[model samples]
Structures are given as structure tokens and as C-alpha cells.
Target: MNQQAISDLITKMADDELVLGHRNSEWTGLGPVMEEDIAFSSMAQDQIGHALALYRIQEEHMGGPDPDAFAFLRPAAEFKCCHLVEMPIGSYDFSLMRHFLFDHAEAVRYESLLQSEFAPLQQLARKLKGELKYHTLHADAWILQLGRAGGESYERMQAALDTCFPLACGIFEPGEADQALINDNIYPGEKVLYERWLDNIYRVLVKASLNMPDPAAITPAYGGRYGQHTPHLQPLLEEMGAVLRLDPAARW
Candidate 1:
């Protein structure tokens, strides 16, 4: 893929991290368990950090002026985050499901990108790859707990799985230039990455004794790679963008 295409993908992934980090950060003091509260909050901060790094790279490459300008000022429809990351955090179970789904997605994405032909992206990806391991451990622990909680917790987890499974599958949504990226070795083949993601996630879910999410015939509900987003994204943008939108040139 060309530099523009790589930058575009980077922007999309950065937006995904930023918005989801904001949502997870909302749980800072509200987790059902104190340990979970701290862990979730810390993970949120890490994601936001990664998002900022990618945003800086993107701003320099794509001539976006700066990272803070576009990230905090763009309208909701302009964000490049999939519906999987934009959904409201309904409950602890829902939050756990979201982490389980998206963390594995991140693992696969960063693993592939670590070997990217694009020099800058590869360097950044190599640095970020280590973070995904920690995220996977966190997701796995929570998933196991929820699965074996064996009461209201188990019931809630099942419900969350049903609600978020479709959205979760959409994390692997193919971009317009995905094939080009594969051909150019900017990323691995889509089939390989998708299979790896599915296998890794399913193994964790299976260990948690959860049934498969029946994703055999799933399709994407939203396509943020093409700038499509959920209605909730608007309000989220309003909150995150309020300061920057008002000031226009304020530095972060």
C-alpha cells in the first residue's frame, strides 16, 4: 500500500483505540470489583496512549496539522471506528465481552503490522505489540471469571455475548484497500489474519466454557473504515470534541 493508504489505516485504528479507551475510562470508579476497576482504568489509559502515538504519526503523514486537532475536533461521522468499539458499556459483563473481542483483534492486527513493509508503521507496530499480550491476559482472566461466576453473572455474560457477538465479528471488517495492502505486503493476507484472530479468540472463549457466538454467517453492522458509525458516536464525539471544537487551535 502507498503511504496515504497506510496512514488512512493508521487513522482508523487510532480512532478505534481513542474512542474505546474513552468508553472504558468511564468505568474508572464504577467497576463491580475493585481489582477490575483498576485494571480496566489502566488498560484504558494504555489504549489512549497508543492512540495518541498513532495520531501523531498520522498527522505528520497526512497533513492533519496535529493529532489533537483531528482527534478531538472531528464530528462523529468523521471518526474511523467500527461499531464494535462505539457501543455503550452496558454492564461489567458487556465490558468484559468487549475487551475479550477487541483485545484479540488488536493482537492479530499488531502482530501482522509488526512485519509490515512500511518502515514507519512497522516500527510503531513492533513497539505496540508487547501491549497486546497484557491486554490478552486481562481479557482471558475476566472471561474465565464471568463464565464460571455461575449465577446472575453467568446469565449476564451469556446475554452480553449474544448482544455483542455480531459487533465483535465486525472488527475484522475489510477496508477498501485491504487487498492492496496485502499485495504490497503492508499487511498479511486478510484470510490469514482473520483465521488467526478467530482461532485465538475462540480458544479463549472455549476455555471459559462459552459456546461459540455463531459467527459462521455474520456480516458487518457498521463500516467505520468507510466513515460509517452508530448514532451513539455523535454524542461521544460531542463530549470528547467539545473543548477542541470550541477552541479550534488549542494544543493538547
Candidate 2:
């Protein structure tokens, strides 16, 4: 196995979870309802847990920094999360659509990793799939309800989907060592995952009476993998690390 390829892949995955987890956590006291507030809070914790586990693998197996320092101390440019995960949690429609699109991609990614030749990742994927199953279920149910409501609710969902589709495509942006990882059976590769994600989400969207935009009509939002981010990320990172940064020597 190419260590660098594996490490890079792990780092990117961890960063995505860390950033999106923080975004999800923002809904803790602010969800549309009590149930939703609790749900997002739960999912946010799961994402952060996933991030911690992945970072531990990197630190133990790839000689990366410990999870705390690596996650809280990295410069925005060093993060490898896709642009999709970095966008601000907008209105409920946007956040919900983002969850629907992003989690499906995540489901496919972890399903592919289940067979990874890398043992640590394979084990982690196994555990994560269980948590992600509920996430997809939640997203699917909400998307269906909103998309078929036949009024402003449906319109808002459709609009959100159109806005998010291109950004979601960025989730599958080819990583620097993606080909090598694919060749080594470390992963099935982004292109394969992207196709699977499209199929998976399409099945649900169709059932919801939603229309998918033409793939060719939308240019995939890209560049987050190469250190480019939306302006929203830095402030998020700063807020996420504020307490930790305040007293570098303080133990949590």
C-alpha cells in the first residue's frame, strides 16, 4: 500500500467530517423543532466521533499529529474537505438538501471502503455504516416529505437541490493520489463512488417527485481538495477552536 496515498485519503475524510460536524452542531439550540434540534445534535456528535477515529488512524499509522492538534490547529488552506461540506448551513431547505445530497455520497464512500485492503479503514467503515444508515434514512424521509408537499415546500426543496447539486459534485473531486489508492484496493475511487451516489439519490428523489438537473448542465464545484474553500470555513474553524486556542496548555 502506498502510505502517502492512504494518509491523504484519511486526512481528507477526517477533515470533511470535522467541518460538517461543526456545521451540524450549530443547529443544536436552533432547529425548526425540538426533534430536529436533537437529531442534528446527535448526527453532529456522530460525525465528530467519525473524524476522531479517522484522525487516530492517521496518527497511529501514518505519523500525523494527534487528533486534537491536527483537527484544531490546521490552517484553512491545509484542510482537504470538499466545498460542499464547507458551505454555511443556510435556511432549513438548503441545510436539508445539503444533508440529503452529502449523506448519500458519504453512504457510498463508506460502502466502498468496507472492502478496503487497509484494515484500519475497513474496520472503521464497518462501524460507521451503521450510524450513516440512520442519517440517510432521516434525510430520505425529510426530503420526501418536503418534496411532495405540493406548495412552497416543494418549490423550496427543488430550488435547494438545484443549488446544491453542483456543490455536491465537488464531493467526488479526484484527489491527488486517488488513482494509486484505487489501484491498490484501498478504495474503489471517486468516479465509481460518484456514479453510485447518483443512482442511490436518484431513486429517492424520484420517489419524492423531484426532478434532477441535467448532469452536464451543472459544472461541479471544485477546488476544496486542493486547499481552496468558501469564505465561510475560516470563521467556522476559528469558532470551533476558540476554547482550545485560548489556553494551549489547558487540558480538556
Candidate 3:
């Protein structure tokens, strides 16, 4: 097996979860409703927990850095999360759209990982499948309700979807190690996952009366996977690492 390829793949997944987990946490006390607040909080916890697990796989099996340090100490340029997850949690509509898109992508990715040749990843995928099921359910339900509301709610959701679609596509930016991962049976590769993700999300979008932008016409926002990111990521990294920087020995 190509350990470097496997480690890079794991790092990308872990970084995505860690960054988005904190973004989701921003809604903890600020959700428009108590239920939403609680829901986001719970999902945030799940994402972070998932990140820790992936990081542990790297540390224990791949000879990677400490989970805490790797997650909190990495510079923005070293993080491998896609740009979609790096963007701020904008309005409720935007955030909801993003969550819908992102969770579904995650669902497909993990489902594919169920067949990974890597035993550790396959086991982790099995455990996370149940959690991701509920996450997608939550996102799907809200997207359907808001999309069918037939007023400002529906309009806003459509607009959010339009804006988020391109960003969501970034979730599948091809990795340098994709061919290696596929050859080794560690993953199915991003292109395959992207198609599956599109088919999966399209069903819900149709039911919601949402029009998905032509992916062929949209240029995905890439570069994050290659250590390049928007201006937003550095600030987020600083904020995320503030506590750790203040006390490097701090334990959560």
C-alpha cells in the first residue's frame, strides 16, 4: 500500500471535518430556533469527534503528528479542507444549503469507504455511517420544507442553492494521490464520488423544486486541497487555534 497516499487522503478528510465542525459550532447558541440550535450543536460535536477519530487513525497507524497539534497547530496552508467548508456560515438559508450539500457529499464518501482496503478506515466508516444517516436526514428534511414553502423561504432557498452549488462542487476537487488511492483500493477516487454525490443530491433537489446549476458550466472553487485557500481560512485557523496557542498543554 502507498502509505503516503493513504495518509494524505486521511488528512484531507480529517481537515474537512475539523474545520467544518468549528464552523457548525458557530451556530450553537444562535440558531433561529432552539431545535436548530441544538441540532447544529450536536452535529458540530459529531463532526469534531469524527475528525479526532480520523486523526487518531493517522497518528496510531500512519505515524502522523499528535491529533491535537495536527488539528490546532497546522497553518492555513497546510490544511487540506476544501474551500466550501472554509467559507463562513452565512445566513440560515446559505448555511442550510451548505449543510445539505456537504452532509450528502460526506454520506457518499463514507459509504464508498465501506469497501476501503484499509481496515481501519473501513471500520471507521461502518461506525460513522449511522451518524451520517441522521445528519443527511436533518439536512434533507429542512431543505425540502424550506424549498416547498413557496414564498420568501422558497426563493431564499433557491438562491442559496444557486450560490452554494459551485462551492459544493469544490468538495470533490481531485487529490494528487487519487490514482494511487484507487489502485490500492483505499478509495474509489474523487471523480467517481462526485458523480455519486450529484446523483444523490439531485433526487432531493428535484423533489424540492430546486434547479441544480449545470455542473459542466460551473468552475469548482478549488486549491484548498493543494494548500491554497481563500483569505478567510487564515483568520479561521487563528481563531480555531487561539486557545491552543495560549496554552499548548491545554487538553479538551
Report the C-alpha lDDT of model 3 over 137-197, residue by residue, as the tens digit: 9999999999888989989999999999988898899988899999999989999999999
Highest-lDDT candidate: 3
TM-score of 2: 0.98
Query: Against the hidden reference, what TM-scores do the models get?
Result: 0.94, 0.98, 0.98
Report residue 36 deviation for candidate 3 (angstroms).
Answer: 0.9
- Write the candidate numbers in order of decreasing lDDT: 3, 2, 1
lDDT (tens digit, per residue) of candidate 2 on 51-70? 99999999888887879988
lDDT at position 28, candidate 3: 88
Worst 10 residues of 1 by lDDT: 213-222
* Candidate 1 global lDDT: 0.82
Alpha carbon lDDT of residue 231, candidate 1?
84
The regions of model 2 sitting more than 4 angstroms off are: none
Ten-residue stretch with the least lDDT total in model 2: 243-252
Clashes (N, CA, C under 3 Å) per candidate: 0, 0, 0
Which tens-of-lDDT digit does each residue in 1-252 have in candidate 1?
466667768888898899999999999999887998999999999999989988887777566547887788777767778898898888778888899888888889888887888877788888977788999998989888878878887788788877888887666677777778888998875567778988997887787777766666656565776778888888988898777777686555
